[model samples]
Target: MSADLVLDGLDKRFPGSPTPALRGFSLTVAAGTCTAVLGPSGSGKSTLLRVIAGLEEPDAGEVRIDGTDVAGVAAEHRGVGMVFQRSLLFPHLTILDNVAFSDRVSGMNRRAARSRAGEYLEMVQLQGFGDRRVGELSGGQEQRVAIARALAAEPAVLLLDEPFSALDPALRSDMHDLLDSVRQAVSPTIVLVTHDRDEAARASDRIALLEHGVLLHEGTVLDAYRRPQNVRASQIMGGRNAVPGVVRDGSHHSALGAVPVPLDTPTGSGTLVIRQEDVAVLDGGVGPADTGSIAGVVESVRVTGARSEIAVRCGDALLHAEAPPTQRCQLGDRIRLMLPTTAVHIVAD
Candidate 1:
């Protein structure tokens, strides 16, 4: 059965570090759901995972699995499987032997453990490669073998700490697909720690954001983008344009001009954040200019995949706008930019 993982009011600090690695950190990963603890380096992302895995002790609070406190539990008895960035597979073992190592150590006989490991290897699509040595496997294959090994243990919870950060972009994507498929088979409660937002979005059912040892936001990925908890959350999750403004009579007055806002918005100084994709640049087409439209001069354009990120200078505020790749835009081109009122999410400065 899958276990629900919970951490409540967790705090941790190193001997000489000025800031605590985790401060009043609290979260709950629902049974069988993948929750990515997303944050940048030194943000306590790995520390949080370590505490839950029983590798590190917390200064305060408790770590619980299925309502039982596990603060004093040994790492091996926590019923958790961990896949680090590297494979860390034993050099002397075959792929099958490596996968079956944990099971055998836990008292399963060699035959039974290998049988179980073989099932998981096939699940990762490495059916016939079981006899191959770890040195002969590709990086992606090694990571897949590592994942297969973790799942083979049949742990109640699985912890993946930047497991694909070393893989190339293409291979990383393949691993992501493999993980997505593998989860449906065993369905372990997973906590995926990643610095990449795309990885977090693609791999998990929900997201828990941490920054400077603080638990800033927790919610579904869509809601996080639609309505960020604060200015930093808005900026971090794709809202790159944060414009300084003040609330006046249910509207934000800024360099771009008055933009309508909710009546209950704090009536004072604030910042309005908008996604670059939401900013529509008019070419005497798309959204034509009127008093409601704001105009800016195109400063630069860079194509990224199917869209072009165009920088527009509107007075003192320079904003980024994403346009279709086919749209013709030139530097120094004066264009009108249309920002729908709904696209503007007000956040504290």
Candidate 2:
């Protein structure tokens, strides 16, 4: 029921766009693995999904499902299930019928299709609302029905195009949990297209990062978080602190001071990437200074929700650190900043 999906040298150029939407983009997703294609608005995230779903033919390159080239194949015959950002359920159909539409179209008997639809409705936790009209259910409920409809067909590949982008924050979180549960029950190879990092990270096993129509990086969630391949990929995953530096011996010498980093890094000028969460802040009253300690003055403090973020000034550069909202540091206060060696990444430019 699940199949491996492969895209090889995919290139799609529209009539008047300045650049191709996808240029030599290639990725191999293992059977039943859920992967998210993450990028900005014009990065072709949805186009990549459309190509895989057979909605658009690639100008050059191929899409293969389970080792069979599906190029030029019809969307219906490709055995791919898709759920768009909008639910798009049939207006005239009842909630039960909307969930069962795929099965009926696939030629299952009326009774059998409704039976299976009821099972899927239960899977999406809408067991009792099957007979309600589509207009009667809420937006979240309709989206759930859309997902249930997609799963009822048992397609080899499932493509979700920002399925939760239209929902409120709380509803989006709930939909994410529901999607995970559905994937567990139906185990289809899934490609989730989303620009939201938290949504992508929550819904996917692996992440394929795209930018400007190119494949930037592809790896497990942990691998991406710990070691992104380049400066662009690192920034996409929230690696915001990039201080100019030079590679010296086997370390990087920056305004923040010299620190050991990857030596096989790019030559000449480069950047030292670090995340806010990785930067450590220590109160001067806590401990005596060591060799690696750096002194800085808190430039600003912002407390939002349960977390507080502060900017620290060291030399001519500024670094950010996050802490509990109860943290007592104020503007102009002196503090110590330490970046764990493991958290530092060198990217030559």
Question: Any residue pairs clashing in model 2, and if so which?
Answer: none
Clashes of 2: 0
Q: Report the error of model 2 at residue 250, Å.
A: 4.0
74-124 per-residue lDDT for model 2 (tens digits): 998898999999899998988888988988987899899999999999999
Which runs of model 2 end up more than 4 angstroms from their true locations?
262-269, 285-288
Q: Which residue segments of model 1 deviate by more than 4 Å?
A: 262-268, 285-288
Q: How far out, in Å, is residue 170 in model 1?
A: 1.3
Clashes of each: 0, 0
Best by lDDT: 1
- Model 2 residue 261 lDDT? 74
Q: Give the alpha carbon lDDT tens digit for every residue of 1-349 in model 1.
A: 4799999999999899999999999999999999998887999999998999999999999999988999899999988889999999998999999999998898999999999889999999999999999999999999999999988888889999999999999999999999888888878899999999889999899988899989888999876675677777776676778888898887898987888876667888888888888887876732556655787888999998999999999888888999898887889888888787777778766
lDDT (Cα, 0-100) at 33 in candidate 1: 94
Error of 1 at 172 (Å): 0.9
